[model samples]
Target chain A: MAQELTTQAARDMAAANGDANRRAMAFTPAVDIFENDKATVILADMPGVAADDVDVTLERQVLTLRGKVTPDAPQGYRQLSAEYQVGDYIRVFTLSDDIDQAKIKAAFKNGVLRLELPRSPKAQPRKISVKSA
Target chain B: MLQTVFSPRNNGDLFADMRRMQSAMNQLFEGTRTAGQSATFPPVNFWASQDSIVMTTELPGLTEQDIELTVKDTMLQLRGTYPEPENGDDITWHRHERVDGTFLRTVELPFRVNPDHIDARFENGVLTVDMQRPEGDKPKRIAIKSA
Candidate 1:
């Protein structure tokens, strides 16, 4: 059997609740991870989230992406029907040792987040020269 | 013997059964949820006012040029295409969850609206459409006077 490359492995992070605070629902954003010879790129759909509201953190080989979305209902309007739920987007990924932590770069535009994780020099493929004896 | 009893084949069968059951459950509960929650891409919310009807939807990874909106009678139509940025041959995909394709969403308004009075705006990937109700269709308040 061949290993499946596209894995939907992201799990929901439990919300913390207290008496004084109400926790809103958090949704898992759809993400795509693509790899080239130089880097691994991740693109996530986070609609309604502003660029400044997104937070990406890497700790102990765990990479977490979180974005806060503020509801944009017009004033003096009552919601009669809703098809999609309003909430924040959260996802986490476990990074392998082959990824260079220091060289990772991320950018957000038009509600899409792009993250590039460059491969370490040692992990890149190199051709070996052979001499005839 | 115990290892063989819990072999890879058995595990695979168990996972397959679980996946099948999950999808079956999803289909069972599909339409019971809110309209947007159960629908396809570009889920929308509808709001009503005395003089206008409003709708909003999220369309990430799209610009104004990628979307088209149309209003006909009491029907509102939305059409858009989300293009994939990377070429298939150039990169190896580890996880592909975001759908990229053309999508069409048609919603029927409760009341007829004036086509000329409709307003739409796309900001930060969210599209809001406001349709003004015809003057006669709006709710009217009648006054009672003493004879």
Candidate 2:
């Protein structure tokens, strides 16, 4: 039941994510996240997204992912086979306060976006070795 | 077995010839050999930098948990699973474009990337892999001796 609920929530979020300016947009972005020693890395799959067209905004605790992809042809060309589309991508994620907002960073290359979210300074690794002074 | 590739048998060696034809057909009806857009394989681009090799691929419609990345030898591989659009069926697609399938794209690396240090991240619809070079391979500044 919970899984179903979450899926439904995502659907709702996607619907609420897009805007009118975009020629097209993706409601969802395929992504993968992992934790490292210093930061959490987030990878999103956005084909056809141009570098200048992407917008990454962090407001309060919500991270919004947005971008636009340029269409290949202006018009009037017969497309032989097209497995990709042109559109903008919009999505939002509620983040925890454990993230260092000021230190968050992002990069877009080859249709992929990488967001680096550093852990809070307090979360840094420290050794609590027993030193009987 | 290696020489058999050159042997004369209709197209080549009987088995080798058949395999070549099959691969060609797959590329035509489907695509060369790309991970299906429906499958886990996201499209990405990888290039070399002065100190590191970077890779990026597309993975729209997936959350963070839907991907898995692994490195072996000098090759990097990504795998993941994602649901097709809710309208996967409803669409009377005049032209279909998303590549979907159980897709795995293996990238061969020119230099070895420290597996322990490999960093994979996702945002928007792209996956970025930060491949750090082995310590010894990194450039170092030499001490300047007095001339």
Candidate 3:
């Protein structure tokens, strides 16, 4: 609990100091975690990333995103002003067993990363009826 | 231009264009797909506005120098050559989705573009081009007269 609070505080501080890092990361990706009959979708905004540049791994219920930015600057560039640094990007998330990892699907379009995580049949919500005698 | 090097004026038909595109595709990206696969470019999403058109290509390991953009009267061309391969790298089973080569993508814009006003900026591995639409195509407000 303390660690979580610390991370939150760090994020708040980062937000307060807008230009502290110069590298922009969304404080939190707008994740619309939904439950249909089967799955949950995680759409992350990770712009400027290509399919080859991203690495998604799931181990022990932990999903991680690792990406390397291609140095898009020209060779031997004596840049006058550099704001965005080409570096590694990493993010991680913990998943519950209710998620059906096998049914997960991912697609990237227009810099948005979409992840569809289907749940196991047993984990799906169902309406139960109470019968009166 | 050397007359011999240029395609004969008579050979500028659709078939000749297809042949040239196919040959260029083969020379650019060879042996990546199936033993005998169809020709295609990797996935990308691009759009345009009234003032400028945007072409966002998925190219990892490519620098701005390796990429070039040229706009003609009605067409936008992008050619990118991948950076030099890592020195004597050994590889095994790898997911190589970063297709790299002398790729040339030519897209005819909806309207003409002024090459002089083409501006490009690269950030976070994405290149954003601000090409001014031809002056004639720009919208201008007309003077209203009393009826």
Candidate 4:
């Protein structure tokens, strides 16, 4: 059988609390978070992740963002040097009660995930939205 | 009896001096963490074959129009600019980690590449560059002549 064209390599997650059952390494993606009177927005960088491979879930007061990367090492090519490790991305954030849980919006483009958490109507009357989100 | 605590030599901003000293201390311990810890903007990975080489780097939230690629002999240059957030001054920042600025990285290929044959593609926020060596530079077997 021929080797797979694309493969996902696993790296050990740094400072990982003992989650021995986890298969692949999970990296905490770099993010930028900002808020206005009406809503809060988050942007995360998760390269090499396609739309279908990412998951965003909200449970209780925690919002989790996970992305799986499928790295393609060209066939028959030997890696000469690697300055960055390729792996999955995972990040979590705690949402306060002021946010409207049902109105959260998420969009992924160009390997960046934008999440918008609209403020609850009863919280405040001020208005703000992060551009398209 | 003791002399005054404020010396005459101090003239500049005290906070600026403290900031500089703090950064100098941070640099002293930065190298001990790992080999990948450096000031390089976007880290890269390289692969090579018999006649070709491939280089890739991750640059999220950027389109092809924001990047520039160039090759000169064995050096490959990549330059890119990240767009700033939509509203610069209005929003309150909760956490600011992503950076916005221009970055330039030049990598030396293992072999002198044929500039005309270089192919680059940007997809999923990753840039992949495939470069080929010139025909004359490829290894060739010489016929052994018996003297």
Highest-DockQ candidate: 4
Please give the distance, in angstroms, between residue A70's alpha carbon in candidate 1 and its true position after superposition: 0.9
User: Looking at candidate 2, what is the lDDT of residue B18?
Assistant: 74
Docking class of 1: medium
**Cα lDDT for residue A44, model 2?**
65
- Summing lDDT over every window of 10 consecutive residues in candidate 3 chain A, give the lowest-scoring window: A1-10
Q: What is the lDDT of residue B74 in candidate 3?
A: 86
Each prediction's Cα lDDT score? Answer: 0.79, 0.62, 0.55, 0.80
Model 4 stretches with alpha carbons more than 4 Å out: A1-24, A124-133, B1-37, B143-147
For residues A1-133, write the lDDT of model 2, one tens digit per residue: 0001123354312443435654454656655655665666666666657778888987777787876666533233233323344455676677766788888889886566778888787755566899898
Fnat, one value per model:
0.84, 0.12, 0.03, 0.84
**Global CA lDDT of candidate 1, please?**
0.79
Off by over 4 Å in 1: A1-22, A124-133, B1-39
Q: Which candidate tops lDDT?
A: 4
In candidate 3, stretches whose alpha carbon ends up further than 4 angstroms from where it belongs are A1-63, A67-133, B1-44, B87-95, B144-146
Candidate 1: give the clashing pairs. Answer: A83-B36, A83-B37
State how far residue B28 of model 2 sits from its true place (Å): 21
TM-score per candidate, in order?
0.75, 0.42, 0.41, 0.75
Cα lDDT tens digits for candidate 1, B1-147 = 555433556656877767777888899988687642335667799888777889999888889899999989899899999976687576887787776788998888988989999899876678889999888777878999999
